[model samples]
Target chain A: MAELELSGVSKVYGAFNALRDVSLQIADGEFAVFVGPSGCGKSTLLRLIAGLDPVSGGRIAIGGNDMTARQAGQRPVAMVFQNYALYPHMSVFENIAFPLQMERRTKDDIKREVSRAAEIVQLSTRLQDRPAKLSGGQRQRVAIARAIVRKPGIFLMDEPLSNLDAALRMEMRAELTQLHRRLGSTMVYVTHDQLEAMTMADRIVVLNGGRVEQVGAPMELYHNPANLFVAGFIGSPPMNFAAARVDAVEGHAARLTVEGLGSFAVSYDGKEVSAGDAVTIGIRPEAMLPGAGEAGHLSFRMTPETVERLGLHTIVHAPVGAKTFTALFNGDPRMARGSALDVSVPLAQLHLFDRNGAGRSIRDIQ
Target chain B: MTFRSGAADAPAFNQNLGAYLFLAPALLILFLSLLLPAAATIGMSFTDISFLRPTNFVGLDNYLRLLSDGRFQQAVFNTSYYTLGVTLPTMVLGLLAAVALNRRFPFRVAFRTIFYLPVLTSLIAAAVVWVYIYEPYSGPMNGLLVSLGLPPQPWLQSPNLAMTALIIMAVWRDFGTAMIIYLAGLQDIPEEIYEAARLDGAGKFAILRRITVPMLSSVTFYLMIILIVQSFQVFGAIYVMTGGGPLGSTETIVFQMYQTAFGYTEFGYAAAMSTVLFFVILLFSIVGTKIMRKGEA
Candidate 1:
């Protein structure tokens, strides 16, 4: 297995910049995911690392060797495309044996290796069937088997599970994580699904607008998103954002006033604050409690417009001033539409951002 | 219940009638142009109705004569050779041209149009142009040979070279059709297949042979049947350029059929020949279509 390193890598297509100065390192045996919204350069970065697309600037190294100028086949890397891309005319045996055949390996060796790889993916029973005869999940397994048959140092997958249905995606995700643990090979996967990233990645590299927004473990990114983009993108129902203004500053604590939510004092680290400075506050939907619990908590009144009782938790969506606020409560609460309720979030969970869209909370400051 | 069932049957009958109405024009054209002529030819094959004599039922007389006819056998051989000669080369040239023009380039569209121009040209017009090109004394064929320090040779005038020369012209005119069909088939193949092949370390030629050729077997079979059927009825080019030519060397089945019916007024014999050709082409078509469907499945 080999670690993958990209330094100052950039890709430009005519007037459009697909990836800009992207640099990251995936440790050997790490399941690093490149996660972002569509057209956010995550797939582009994966392709660059795979050597399928050439970089416009900087370098890519795999196993500490320069692979920036190498052809895709010449690199010590294998890719599983988004669509599986199995050769329709080939049987599963031939599909998995393709890379070995390309290397002109001995017939017996090819058979042995192909069978082993297929067995790992639990596809040994369907060896003689053509890809057309197989289901979508089986075809995906064939693509993976083909990639693994070559025994490449690094595996690159470009949104490989996006085509499968939800149930199959979850099963494949668990299988892939188990496969990673079994093989101990470096894998760089790209996806626009944050849930996939959160569940599967040893580290998730969040990208936006052709640039790296943040890079951390799943919970690390969830707990401490570096900017507004990561904060909005990393969580489901996303984190709620509200405009607030600093009413006054006292030493390391700032008193902020939010329209319709009254004023509260939040302790900070090193960020300089002055009177009447506009700021944004973020709190996740799940962090908001049902009632105004005790004093010193940021509390607000909201009229529920819609309520979704999802058995274990009841999610309420309501309007607070100009923005919609979402609150998730454990167990089903008697929440009704058009009814006003007070919700509170602990001060420690509030995420503060300045006017520039940069995180200015205590976690970010330290 | 009876009334409701009767009302439902009425709409179903009307729907059937509407569908038949939509199909009527095409069915009428097919019957008048194809089925009627085939049936008439088969009936006429059993008769000696030449219009110059009292019509009589000849029964198996025409068939028995055809069995012993030396000229007819020669025409059959020449037609087979011409079909084999044209179909293979045309398919190869067409596939190569299609693969080349499939890529993006500055003049790709212009090149594709130029390559496909021959398919749009009239057969009579193209045959006349080729006849001049093979005109021996002043033709460019001999002119080019003489320039290359070789002695000039007559192309269409020599019995040995006339059939070959006709086959060449027919290939030049027909490969464009093969190319267009192949281009359409190429479009049906996904681009990701090629990219996967490239990433698998397959070079250009390997991908064409292993992936492209196998994937397009159905298209190739279809083109072969079409070319063979068209080649079996190779009358217009032969009639215009060679007219069955020097020493009857290029006398194909359809060309001989034309001469037999018109020149000798042997309409019964010509009808028998047409019936044989029709059956042969039909067999080829049925086999081709069955294989294509199986491949798709």
Candidate 2:
């Protein structure tokens, strides 16, 4: 196992910049996931790390050795493609043994290693079957088995679970976490699914528009996002946003006039904001508690337009001045359509952002 | 339920009838052009019908004679040599050209079009051009050989070299077709497969030998059947360039059949040859298709 380090790595295609000055380090035995939207340069970064593509600028080092000019075949890395990329003509045994065969290992050694990988992925019984004959999950296991058989220092997965169904994706996510624990090898996975990153990654690197937005543990990012994009992207149903103006500033406390929600006193650790400064306020849907009138809490009135009862929680979607405000309540609540409900959130849970989409909240400052 | 079923049945019947109407023209053409000639050839093979004599039933007489005819046996051997020589080399050259041209390079489209021009040329025109190129005295082939300090040899005149020369020209004219088909097959393979191979530590030649060739097996099988069937009927080129000359060294089954029917007015014997050739080609096609299906499975 080895750590991966990329410094100022950039990729440019003609005039389009696919990745811009991306630099990060993953510790040995760490499961780091690069998460972003489509075309956010997550997959491009993975390809660069795999040495499948050359960087337009900067250097890459694996295990503290410079690997900038090495070919992909010469790198100490193995990759699992999004579609598995199993050789359709080969049996599972052959596919798993491909890397060993490329190294010209003896017949007995290849058989031993392939069987070990197959056993790890629970595919030993189906070793002789062609990839076309296997189900989607089984094919994914074959790909993982192939990567494992190589015993590379680093494993790169490019959205490997995206092709599986929802249930299978969940199962594979848990399996991958267990695999990471068992292997204890550095893995850099790229995905557009935030849930997958949140569940499986030891650290999640959030990317947007070819640049890194934030990198932190899952709960750390959830509790304190670095910017407006991370705040909205990290949580399900996302965080609600509302425009607000600072009415007054008094010693790390701001009195703000929130649109359609009246004024409130919120604490901050940053420099005093001048009066009449514009800022955005955010509150998560799940953070909204039922009923209002909690002293020192931020409260608002919303007319529910749609109510979704998903067994444990009732998600109430309502309109508050041209924006959709969602309030998730524990268990099922008696929420009716077009009825105004008083929803309150703890004042400490509020997120404040500058007009530039940069986080300027007390939690972020801490 | 009965009323809905009755209403749906009428439209379904009309839809099928319209489909059949659309298919009728092509089916009729196939029957007239292919099935009719095949049936007539089979019938004529059983009768000694020719311009030299009155018609008479001669069941299995022509077949019995073919088993013992030395000229027909020589023609069969020449045809097999030409087919094997042309097909194997054409496929190999075509696959190499396709793999080289599959990459993005300057003027790739221009190069592809240049390689494909031979396939679009008329067969007789191509044959005539090749004959000129193989012209012994002042042809480019001999001139290049002379420049390279090799003895100038007669390309189409020597009996041993005559079949080889025809096979060379046929490959040059037909590898373009194989290349075009291979280029299409190359497009169907996913790009990620190559990336995975590279990450798996496979070099360029290994990827080609282990991944590319195996992946294109179905396409190869298809091109093989086409080339075999077409080469088995190699008449036009040999007719234009060799005319079954050089001691009948370059004569193939179809060329001999033409000479038998039109040259000597032996229509009954030629019909027997045609029937035999048809069955051979059909057997090759059936076997090829079966192997291709197994490969797919």
Reference contacts reproduced by model 2: 0.88
Q: What is the DockQ of each candidate?
A: 0.68, 0.87
Q: Is the docking of candidate 1 incorrect, acceptable, medium or high quality?
A: medium
Give each model a TM-score. Answer: 0.97, 0.98
Clashing pairs in 2: none
Fnat for each predicted structure, in order? 0.59, 0.88
Candidate 2's residue-wise lDDT over A1-366, tens digit each?
Answer: 999999999999899999999889899999999999999999988888888889999899999999999999898998999999999989999999999999999999999999899999999999999999999999999999999998989999999999999999999999999999999999999999999999999999999999999999999999898778999999887899998899999987899997688889998876636789888888999989989858868887888899999989999988877688888889988879987788999888888888744654433533
Q: With candidate 1 superimposed using the best TM-score fit, by how many Å does residue B271's alpha carbon deviate from the native?
A: 0.9
**Model 2: lDDT to the true structure:** 0.91
Off by over 4 Å in 2: A357-366, B1-13
